[model samples]
Target chain A: MAAARKKETFWSEPISKVDLQRPAVVPSGTSIIDAVKEMKYNQIGCVLVVGADQKIIGLLSNGDLMHEYVGSTLPGDTPVDTIMTENPFTATPALTVQEALEIFHSNPFRHMPILNGEAIEGILSIRGLMVFISEHLPLEVMNLPPDSSLIATHAAGE
Target chain B: MEGLKEYLTRQDFVSSSEVRWCPGCGDYAVLNSVQNVLPQLGLPKEKFVFVSGIGCSSRFPYYLDTYGFHSIHGRAPTIATGVKVANPELSVWVVTGDGDGLSIGGNHLVHALRRNLDMNIILLNNRIYGLTKGQYSPTSRKGQITKTSPYGVLEEPLDPLRIALASEATFVGRAVDTDPKHITEVLVAGAEHKGTAFVEILQSCVIFNKNAWTEVSDRSCREDRLLYLEQGKPLIFGEKRNKGIILKGTKPVVVTIGEQGIKKKDLVVHDRHREDPVYAAMLTKMDYPDYPLPVGIFHAMEKPVYEVELVKQIKEVTALKGRRNLQGLLRGSEYWTVSNKGKTIKRSTGISSLANDESKVMDERIHALLKSTDPLTASLKNTIGKIFYDYDYKRSKMLSPRDSIASAIALFKAAKIECILVGDAKRLYGILSERDIIQNVVLTSVDRDRMPISSIMRPVYEIMDESNSIGDVINILSISGHRHVPIRLKDGGFGLVTIRQILRFIHDTVEQVEKKESEDK
Candidate 1:
C-alpha cells in the first residue's frame, strides 16, 4: 500500500519563504519629510523609526502622514515620531506567514517589521505573501487565460 | 495659470500605502492607468477626490494620494453627489463594483447618472462579488453558479453601459483592464467631459471569478473579439479588419467587407454624439460569438451639469429673497409658546389665532395621573420567614450534583426560574444560577452537555435563619451579587428566597398605597 500523503497548509509556511525586502529605516528624530523621502526612494509603503540601539520605536506609513499632517499646519520638518504609531506590532523571523497575514488583515496596515531578537531583519508585506502564494499555486490557476471552457457553471459541492 | 506650478506626474498621485489587491487582479491595471491619466488633466492633486463604496474595486481611493472618501456600502454615488454639490470646484470621482452599485445602490446610481452631475463614475464590472468572496453579483450571468447560488443564478445580468445610456448620462464609455493604454485614454476623456461621464471597465477578480472577461480581455483573441468604436468611422473589427457590423432593419449583422461586397460606407457609422441614445443602446447589446464587443465611447453629448445648475438656482433664490435670516424663516407667519402652567399661548403677527384649550387640558390630566403613582417602599423589618413561605418554595427545582449542566438549564427554562438547588432537601450542596452557567459553563470551554452541575455551582452552606429580618437578606444579596439564597425555615424545612420576591413585595406595597390614596380623594 502507498504511504499516506502529508497534507500541506498554505498559511503555516515559514516567513523565510516569503521574498522579504530590506525595510526602510529612519532614525527616531528624522524629519517627516526626510523619512518620507527615504520611503519613496526605497519604493516601500512604510518606514521603521528606530532608536539609537537600532530597535524599532515606531512605524510610520503614508496613511498616517496623510491623516495627521498632509494638509495640516504642521511643518514638513516636524519629527516623524510625532505621527508614527508607537510600539507597532512586530513578528520574528520564526513566525509563520499566516500569523503575519492575520496581523495585516486585522489592522489597517499593509506592511509589518520583521525582527530577530531586537535586531531589524526585513519587512514582510501582504503583497509579498500574495506573490509567494500565487507562485506556489497550480499553474493552471496562476496562468489562467480567459477561456469559456474553464468557466464552471455549477459548484463543486455535491 | 498653467505655468505657475510644476506639472504633476504619475508618482505624485501614487499613494504610500501598498496596493493590496491580489496578484494579477485587474484592479491593479485600472489603478495604474488612473494614476497615469490624472496628471494630464491639469487639475491640482488636492482638487481631485475619489469616493468609493464597499468592495474590492472600492479600494481605489486608498491607493491614490488624492483626498478620497471610503464611504459605506452602496452609497458612493450619494456621497460623491454631496461632495460635488458642496464644492463644485472639486473634481469628484465615484468608484464602485458591480455588486456595490448594481445590486444595492442601483437607485442612487441611476438617479445620480440621470442628473448629469459634473463628475466621473467608474464601474469596475467583474461580474462577481470578490470582496465578500465568490458570490454571484447582480451582473453575474444567468445560469452561472457561485457560492450564494449553488444551483446557478436564475436572474438575467444587468448591463452597466446600457443602464448609463438609459439614465441619460452625458458621456458613456467602456474599457478593459487588460488594455491599460485604452483605459487611460478613456478615463482622460471621461474626466474632461463637462457633465456626468460613466465608464464601465471590464476587469477580472483573479480569485473568486477568475478570467470573467476572458472573451473580451484575453490578449490572444481580444482584437478579433473587440470593436474599437471611433466617431465617423465604420464599426469594423476582426484581426484582418474585414468584419464589419451593418444595421439590417434595426438589427446588427456581422458582414465581411470584401467578400460580401459590403463596403466601409455600407456599415454602420459610429456617431457617439447623436442626441438620441438608440444607437448607443444598440452598441451596448453587442456581445461575443455573434458580434464584437464595443470598447470605446458609445455616447457623448453636452448637457447642463447638475451641480452647476443647482448652485445657480441657489444663488438666484438668495437674490430674490433678499438674504432672509434663518430665525425669520423658521418663525414664518406664526408659532405657539407653551407656558410652565400648561397654557399653550397662540400668537400670530398680523394673522388670526385660536387657543388649543383641549391640548392644555390633556397635558394637565396626564401630569395629575403621573403624580398619583409615586412608588411606596416596602417595610424591611418584615421577617425572612414570612416572605420565604409566601414564595411558594415548592416550585423551586432541586437537582443532584451528578446532573448535567444541560439538564439544569432545561429545568431552569421549564420552571421559569433563574436558579436551581443542587442536592436533596435534607442535605444542601450548592446553588446553580443562570449567571453561573453563563459565566463559567457557557462562556468557558467546558462542555455543558456532559459537564456536571457541580463544576459550575456555588457552594452555599451559610443559610440565612428564618428569624432574620428582610433587610439582612437584602444586604447579603447586594454584597455577594447572589440572585437566590437558601433559607432555613422556622418549621425546619428548606426554602429559597430570591430577589424577585423582594421586588414583588415592593410593587404590591406601592399598588395598595395608590388604592388607599384614591379612595380617600
Candidate 2:
C-alpha cells in the first residue's frame, strides 16, 4: 500500500518528454478505410479530428468501430462527429500525472486529448502509461532475495 | 444521607444488547467500573450516554441501558458534540481506543479537547485494532510485528496521554484496567470533572499485542512497576515499598528510599491542581523499565466549557437583537412566483433565471444525472474504479455463525443491508439474508436472540466476471433473484455488483430516449 509513499507527479513532466507518437488523426469526412489503414500502420488504438484551428472536435477509438460501425448500418464516409462521444472528457499538457491518471482511471474511455488552451497539443493514451511502466519494469520473473533462512520452516530444526 | 435512596443503581444502566467482546478482555472490567461509577455520580441513568467509535471497545453503547449512539470510526466526538449542543443536560462519555482515537479520529479528538467540551473521553489503549483481527494500529510501537506490518511496524507509537495534555485537555488521567480499584477511582473522577476529561486506560488484547502491559499488569511485578499518584504524597512503589521517585531538574529518577541518603521528603509529590501542563506531560511521557508508569489523575483544572458558553452566547444574541418567529424569518424579503394554469405570472427574485423554463430543464438534467445509471455494467473488463461500496467487505458488519442472531439483526438493521457475509476476516463461510431469516426464522418458535445465523445462512451461489454482459446479468438476476453478486476484481481480489446498478442502466436508457423525444418535440 502506497498510502504513505510519496507519489511522483508524472503529468508535470513536460509534454515534450511524454511519448508524442502521432495518434492517428483524420478529417471528419475521411472514410473508415483510411482510418483503419492508418491504425494498422501505426499500431495505435484511436484517431482524432483536428478542426481548422487545430482544436480537437471529435475522436474515434476502436471501441466505436467495433461496437457500432462494424456490425451496423453506418456508411464508411459518414462524419466522425456523428458517432464520437460528444463533449468527451479531456486533459491539458499542464495537467499533473495524478490528475491525468484520475481522469484515465475514473472514466470507461481510455484515450484522452491533451490540449493547449482548446488547441490540440497531443493525445495521451492509457496504453502509453502501461508501455512506460513495462519499459521500466521488464516482464521477467522477479527473483526472491538470497536469504535462504527466510523460508518458512517448523519451530525446530526438523 | 437523605438522598441515598434517590441514587440510581448499576442494574438500571444495563441494556439488552449482548456484550460481545472476547472473553477475558480487559473491557469487561472497565465496563463494570464505569457502570459502578455512573450510579455514584447521582445523575439519572437517562443523563448518561456512552458514545464510542469503531473498535472492540466502541461496542460500549450497546451494553448500556442509557440512550446511546454507536457512531462511525473515529468520529464519535463529532456526534457527541451535536448531542451535547442539542441537549446540554446530558452527560456524554466517549469510549474510543488507540486506533479509533489516535489514528483516524485524531483530528476530532484534538479539537474536542482543545475546545474543552463538557464530556468524558475514556480511551481504551489496547495498542491494536482487535476487531480487524491483528493489524498494526497507529499506537503500535515501532518494530511491532502485526498482520499489516509483517516485517515490523516502523513508525513510532503514539503516546495518547501526552497528546491529551498537549491538546490543552482540562482534565487528563491514566489507569490500567488490570487494577480494578484504580480504574474505578479514575472513572469516577473522569465523570465528575467538567470539560473534556481524557482518561487513557491501558488494556490488554490477549489475542494480539498480548502482555503489552505485563510489567505493570502482572500481579507478581505490578506493585513495583506501577506508581499510583496522590496529591501531596511522595511517590513510592516496589515490592519492599522502599522505592520512590525523585526529580532531577525536570526529569524523574526512580530511587530506593533510604538508600544513599535518599529520603521520602526528597521525592516528587503529585500536584494534580498544578495550572501548568508540564508536570502532567512529564508524568505521561515516562516509559516502563526506566520510570514506573504513572497512574491516576495527571491534570485537573477548569476552563469555560463549550456547551455552557454556547448556550450563554445564544441567549445574549437573542437579547441583543429581536426575536423573530419562523414565519417572519422565512418571509424575510424572499420572493416566489407560482402559476396554477396557462397564465404567466411574474414575482421577481429579480435574478429571474431561476424562474426560467430552460433553467428548470437544466435542473431536470441534474436530476437525470443523479438517477443516471452506470452506462456500462461491472463487466469482465475494469469499469469504474473502486469506491466506498467496493470496500464493503472491509466495512461490512461480519459475524460468525455461532454469534447471536440478535447481533446479526442489529448489524443488518444498522447497515440497512439485505444481507451480511457470515465469517471472519479469513473467509466468508456463508451469507445471511432477510429472505433466509423470514423463510426460516419468524415461521418457527425459535428464540430470536439465541438463534444462530448458521441455521439460516444461504451459501453464496456463484461468482460473476466482467465478461458477463448486462443481458447475462439480467438472466442471472431473474433466475436466482440475488440482489447482490460478487464480481472478479481487476487487481486479483474480488468486488461486488448489485441488481440495483443493472436496473439503473435500464432506467437511464429509458430516460435518455425520453429526453431525445422531448427535445425533438
Number of the predicted model whose lDDT against the real structure is largest: 1
Q: How well is each residue in B1-521 modelled by candidate 2, as lDDT tens digits? A: 33642667888787777889888899998998887787888777778888888999999999989888889999998889888889888989899999999988999999889988888999999888899999989788889888999999999888998889889999999998888889989888877788989999999898898876876788888888889888778888888889988889998888998889999898888899999998888888887888888899989998999999998997996887645466754554435455788344444443332225554555555444323133222121122223213434453356888897767766655565555667665555677765455334323446767878887787777655554444444444444546556554455444455543433343344346558769999
- DockQ each candidate and list the results: 0.01, 0.02
Candidate 2 chain B superposition, TM-score: 0.63
Cα misplacement distance, residue A82 of candidate 2 (Å) = 74
TM-score of each: 0.50, 0.49
Candidate 1 stretches with Cα past 4 Å from truth are A1-158, B4-6, B331-521
TM-score of 2: 0.49
For model 1, residues B397-470, the per-residue Cα lDDT tens digits are 78999998878766765575656778775777899865565445322457867899988899994677787656
User: How well does candidate 1 score on lDDT at residue B332?
Assistant: 61
For model 1 the local lDDT of residue B519 reads 100
What lDDT would each prediction earn against the true structure? Answer: 0.78, 0.70
